[model samples]
Target: MPDRNSALRGQRIHGQFGNISKEPGVTFREIKDFSYLEITLWDWARDSLRSKLAELLGIGDLPDTGDSQRLKEGRLLHLADGSLAYLGAAAPADILEVAITPEEGCVVPLGHARCLLRLEGPKAVALLRRGIREDLRDTAFAVGQVMTTDIGGIGVLLLRPDTAKFDLLVPRSHAIEVWRWLTRRAAPFGYEVL
Candidate 1:
C-alpha cells in the first residue's frame, strides 16, 4: 500500500452542508460518487491494448481516434482507448484491483493529479462564470470538454464531464484556497460541495 501520510497531504474539514473536505489543500466533494477502472498501456502497445480493452469491456466498437471522439458518462468506455482504458465510473474497486497488476505494463490507480468540486443548483454556471475567464457558454464549451485554464487567478484544469457538473483540477498546494474561493462564489448560487 502507498504511504497513508503521503496520500493525504492536506487536512479534511466538514462544513455544515454535505461538503466534506478531504484535505486542507484537497477535497473529495463527490460530484458523482463515480467508480472507474482505469488501465494505462505503455506507449508501444496502445493499439493492442485498445482492442483488448474493448473486448474486455464489451464495447463492440470504440470511438474513432480524433479530437471529436469522446466517451459518454456512465457507459463502459475507453478514455484514450488506444493508450488508456477506462471502464467507466461506479465499477467495483475489488474487480479493478484484480484486472490490473504490476505486469502487463499496467499501472493501477493511475497517478493522475486531480481535484473535483461538485457544482449544483440553478446558478452554478453563474458562479463559475465569475471566477473563470473562459467562456462557460454552452456554445463555446460543451459537456465532456477537458479544458486546461485558470480560475480565480490560479491555473486550473476544468472538465465538464457531465451536464450540470464540473470538475476542477488545481495544483495540490492550491487546493484548499481554491476550494474555499469556489464555495464563496457558489454562495449566491446555492452551491452544495457534495
Candidate 2:
C-alpha cells in the first residue's frame, strides 16, 4: 500500500475517501453513505427468490428478469447474471442472520471487501468515456441502471442510481489505481477532491 499521507501532499485530497462532496466541478470520493450487501441465491432457487430477498431488505419488488440491466435507486438491483445487490437507505441486519439459512441465499457486506467511488457532475458521463466503451447515453444506460464492467482493466460495478451521478464499486486492492485513473481522466474536466 502506498503512503496516502505522502502521496497526497500539496493536493486537496484526504486518506481513504477523498474530500466528500466538498470541492467544485466533478466530485470524486469513496462512497461512505450507504450500506452495500451482496446476496447470492442458490441454484435451485426460483425467480421469486429475488423478490423474497428484496422484501427481506425492504427495497420493494425486483426489476423483471428481462430488464436485468436496470437498477433502481433505493431498491433492489438485479445483476445480469441473476444475482442481487441492495443499494437501500439503511444499514442491513447482522450478516450471520441474513446468511444463516443457506437454502435462501447469503448476504455479504461489501464495505470491507470493496470500496465504492461516486462521481457526479455535468461531465460525469464524458469522464467515464475515457476508460469505458459502453453506450452511456440516457436512452441506453438510464438512471437506476447498473452494469458490471471493466474500467481501466479493473472490474467495477457501475451504477447510475441518480442523474448525472455514477457509483463505481472497485476492489480494495485496485481502488488506488482506479482512483488515479479516474482523476487523470477528469483533469481536463476540472475535477476536485470532493
Winning model by lDDT: 2
Pick by TM-score: which candidate is best? 2
Question: What would the per-residue lDDT of candidate 2 be over residues 112-165, giving only the tens digit for each residue?
Answer: 567768889887899898899899999988887788889889998888867799
Off by over 4 Å in 2: 1-25, 58-60, 65-74, 88-90, 93-100
What are the RMSDs of all candidates, in order? 7.1, 5.9
**Minimal lDDT window, size 10, model 2:** 1-10
Instruction: Write down the worst ten-residue block by lDDT for model 1.
Output: 1-10
lDDT per residue, candidate 1, 100-177, as tens digits? Answer: 445545645432343445554445667678888888887777775555577778887566656556666455566667
lDDT of each: 0.50, 0.66
- Model 2 residue 155 CA deviation in Å: 0.4
Prediction 2 TM-score vs. true: 0.76
* Error at 132, model 1, angstroms: 3.1
